[model samples]
Target: MKGGPVLILGATSGMAREIARSFAACGHPIQLAARNVARLEDDRADLETRHGVAVTLHEFDALDLASHKGFVEGLPALPDIAVCAVGAMGTQEENAANPEKGAMVMRANFEGPASILGHLANAMEARGSGTLVGISSVAGDRGRASNYVYGSAKAGFTAFLSGLRNRLAKTGVHVLTVKPGFVATAMTEGMDLPEKLTADPKEVGHAIRIAVQSQKNVIYIRPVWRLIMAIIKAIPEPIFKKTEI
Candidate 1:
């Protein structure tokens, strides 16, 4: 393998799975992590056979913050690059009816990703080299009632990655904040997202891999999102709040 061991959180999901495949194609060992380890057997086998690289599966649950420390320590080898693809987009209406759903959305999207990446930050800092990739969302550019639960969590995650990158800049470690506006994945299956602004999971994989290799601080999966979010963020709150997404 060329690249060092690369750990991918939420590996069984849409974007994360594609990312694992992309790195594996480049002869990088894959450490696929998610809640249902058994479901990843197919992906693991495919990566191993197709790319002729090692594929290791680790059971990971983003909600279980207590296990994050042990999870890193237990890795067979320290990862040279880590990607946090863990996120959940819950229904705002259902979330309003069930506040716990909002809490889960926050924890799954931000708290857990931050917890694991925080641990990696400390380790990578001590080691003095590593790439941290956090997949945030464009929804975070501003809170829209349409998806504020998801947006707010992504906002926190984006801020966290920014701080981590700043702190680790002096060191060899690089942290990247990835804000993907809209993507066609299981998470967004029900939502009718616009075509131009939305990207595919494979596209997300490409952006993340490139960002990690180049050590960019921030990236929009599709360049169009930069312009879209720029306009969204530029709008006045009073006017924005009245306009629906």
Candidate 2:
């Protein structure tokens, strides 16, 4: 699982791109997959030239379930590791006002990512090797009214990853769940996130690389999030519902 190519789904994402760079720096062949072929190619060239490792690009659309199987089948070889960073966090107000928007958020964060991982998990289990890493969120631990639409989707995704990990435990394939709090990236570019709590994409990238190498099952990128979420989760529902997060 360590030597083969690492396939990064949603490769063009700020976080995923950083993770790809980290792995590429470690001499792992990179298979960059995302909806933007142009961006993937750009990244391919950069990683190859910078890290001196083989980098391949693949066109991937997370919501396209029908295409997922064919996408994996088309890889040059089965990847030793797969990182899923596919997610969409629409505005809470927008998602609350529009059912379609909420549905899209749910699909992007849960259904679509889960569908692709299901395929990858089966393939890896059959081979009795490989690793699956999922980028979830701390919001999933407790659904706040501010972003329930996004949080609920991540909650489902977290549960899915946990179940997948349990099923694959005896199979040799490792599954790692990464829950990051506020990350400084395009996804939260305009928000005034706290400097102490917000993590840089490269910091997240380095953490994920270490977690995978160490075969960790679950990790919170910022350890403070574990304590914060625990307090929120411990609140009584009646009182918690009355307070804003």
Candidate 3:
């Protein structure tokens, strides 16, 4: 099924752009939102031609909490499905130097994405139908010494999605929690990532689309991460706090 008109927040990012392409190919109208509309014109055009679908660019600022409601109200059409792929992974060293820098990590990963998705969820609930996908991370499963700043925010986001899902459960809206392990994108270009757990943008896109079709509640992009996170989360707190990831 073509499902419904699709809206992607953070559409300029690697995974979001891939998702836009994947759905556009299936003949769904697309609304892509990001900070720079000018930069994504090429992506819009490519998807429009390749899929013969209508592609519209929307200017969005995730951190602009007050603007989220207006942003959703202004959409040309109430989307059938909304996918949020907006998040940031700041350098742990830089985040440690300043609290202001650290705050951005929390806002970007949790506050901003949650604000938008929360707004979308309300709209869908009113309509009595829709699907919502929140792209979170496995790091949220537990805090590690290496990237707790980023991971902590994701943890909050994960919880928010869970609560949103529960609230909308009877409203006929489907909510999906996506936990991608390690992704090789501009955000992680220089990092050393293991081959076993990392996924490229295409793989993330594919997993999301399939999950949507299946109406899955929670999914780990690399299935093994489900096992890995289980172990990490199961570890005793005393030992976990002592070990460095």
Candidate 4:
């Protein structure tokens, strides 16, 4: 049987597009929301043509906190599955050097995503059914010097998802937290990521689909990340702070 409508926020990103494709392929109608709706025309057309599923686009800006409630209210209908693939990985050096830049990254990765999901969570709780997926990062498991700013933001988001999950446990609303360690996408084009540690957008996308279907509370896209983060977290802070990862 076909699933209910799926909504993907930040639909312009490579990961988000692939997630949309995954759901579309499964006969789920898609609603893509991003800052630039016009740019999503090609994606909308491609999904409809390839999957023979309905695709709709809406303009959404994550940083626009005030618009979040209105955005949810405006949806044609509450999605059975809503995924927040909204995040930006600003360079560590840049973020550290510019407070403005660091704040932007913070707001982008945490505040914006959490706000939107909060609104969606309320709606889903009222309806007593729906899946909320937040794409967080493994960096949040423990903060490192390499990208502490981004890591901290994701940490907050991870915590938010956890609390949301706890609060909605008996409400029939499910929340999922996805930690995609190292995804190879345009955002990380120039970074030197270990081949084995990095996953393609398609892999992450498919993993998320399966996780949602299985009603998993949290998942590390690559099982190894769970181990890696555990090791990192287990290290004593005094010694860990001195070493450069």
Candidate 5:
């Protein structure tokens, strides 16, 4: 393997799984971590068999705030690249009706992912080199009525990655913020997404792999999202609030 093992948090997710495969194909050792460790055993074996690289599985529950530190400490070895593809998007109506649900979405998208990355950042800083990839969303660029709860959380994560990238710029550790426009994942299974704007998991995986290799500070999975979000963000708040997305 060229680089140290590539650690993928929330490995069982569609996007993360594709990313794992992409890295494995490039001869990077793979460490897949998620709550469903058992379910990922077959995937681990497949990656090893297909890519001729080592693949290990670890149990990780993003919501378990207290375990974040131990999870990093328990890794077999520090990874050269770590990708945080951990997130949850609950229905906006449901989240608005339940404060707990809103909090859970917020924690899943921001707090939990941020906590683990924080620990990883410190470790990478100490080692003086590594890459951190955070899978934020284009939804973060603006708050819309359809999914403001999720959007707000992503906004926080985007900002967090930005700050981390700034701090680590001089420390040798690179931080990449990835904003995917619309991805067809289990999380958005039934949603009607625009075909032109939506990207598949594998496409996203490839984009991220390229970004990491090129050390891109920020990326929109489909380049058009940069323009789309730019237009959305430019709308005046007074006019924006009156329309539904």
Candidate 6:
């Protein structure tokens, strides 16, 4: 079904680009927002040319909380659907050693994302219609020692989305939390992700499109991740702490 304009935050990311393509192909006008406006020129042109949908670019800084309100206010129009794909997954060792780095990771994954989405949620609620999609991670389901710093931030974001969903349940604003396990993106380019568990960026994009259309509350991009995370979460803390996953 064709809908009104869809806004994608952190549009420069590999996953976000694919998401924009998915929605554009479905005849949805797209607004791409990122910290680097000039970087989106190619994307905007490509989307417009390929999908024949209006594509606009806007400057957005997730870390600049003060600019979020103004950023939303300056949008040409309130988006019918807004997706938050902003996040940072720093190395656990570095994060643990450098407090500032850890805090930056936390803010990027949770605080920055939550702050911006919170603004979008308020506007959407006031308008009495909209879908909010948050691209969280399965790492949030259980904090592993290897990536606890990044995982903890995602956990907070997951909770934020849940609470936002609950509060807006009766207000016509739908919230969808997407937990992707091992997405093959620039972020995980060098990591040795399991072939069976990993998903391509386009797959995630397509899954998100379907979820939004179906009004799904939460989903694991790859179904296997659901089972995998469940098993991880079920492990006894005493045993889980002893081994590296």
- The digit string of per-residue lDDT tens for model 3 on 114-215 reads 999989999999999999999999988998888888999999999999999999999999999999899989988989999988999999988898898899
Candidate 2 regions with alpha-carbon error over 4 angstroms: none
Q: Model 4, stretches more than 4 Å misplaced? A: none
| Runs with alpha carbons beyond 4 Å of true place in candidate 5 | none
TM, every model: 0.97, 0.98, 0.98, 0.99, 0.98, 0.99
Query: Candidate 2, 97: how far from true, in Å?
Result: 0.3
Ranking by lDDT: 4, 6, 5, 2, 3, 1
lDDT of 5 by residue, 1-245 (tens): 37688999999889998999899999999999999799998889889889889998989999998999999999999999999999999899999999899999999999999999999999999999999999999889998989989999999999999999999999999999999889999999998999999999999999999999999999999999999889999999999999888
Worst 10-residue lDDT window for candidate 1 reads 206-215
Which structure is stronger by lDDT: 2 or 4? 4
RMSD of 5: 0.9
Query: How large is the C-alpha RMSD of every model relative to the true structure?
Result: 1.0, 1.2, 1.0, 0.7, 0.9, 0.7
* Candidate 3 regions with alpha-carbon error over 4 angstroms: none
lDDT of 4: 0.95
> 1-245, model 4: which lDDT tens digit per residue?
58899999999999998999999889999999999899999999999999999888988999999999999999998999999999999899999999899999999999999999999999999999999999999989989989999999999999999999999999999999999999999889989999999999999889999999999999998899999999999999899999898
Residue runs of model 1 more than 4 Å from their true location after superposition: none
The CA lDDT of each predicted structure is: 0.90, 0.92, 0.92, 0.95, 0.94, 0.95
**Candidate 3, 160: how far from true, in Å?**
0.3
Higher-scoring candidate on lDDT, 2 or 6: 6
Better of 1 and 3 by lDDT: 3
Candidate 1 has a TM-score of 0.97
After superposition, the stretches of candidate 6 with alpha carbons farther than 4 Å from their true spots are none
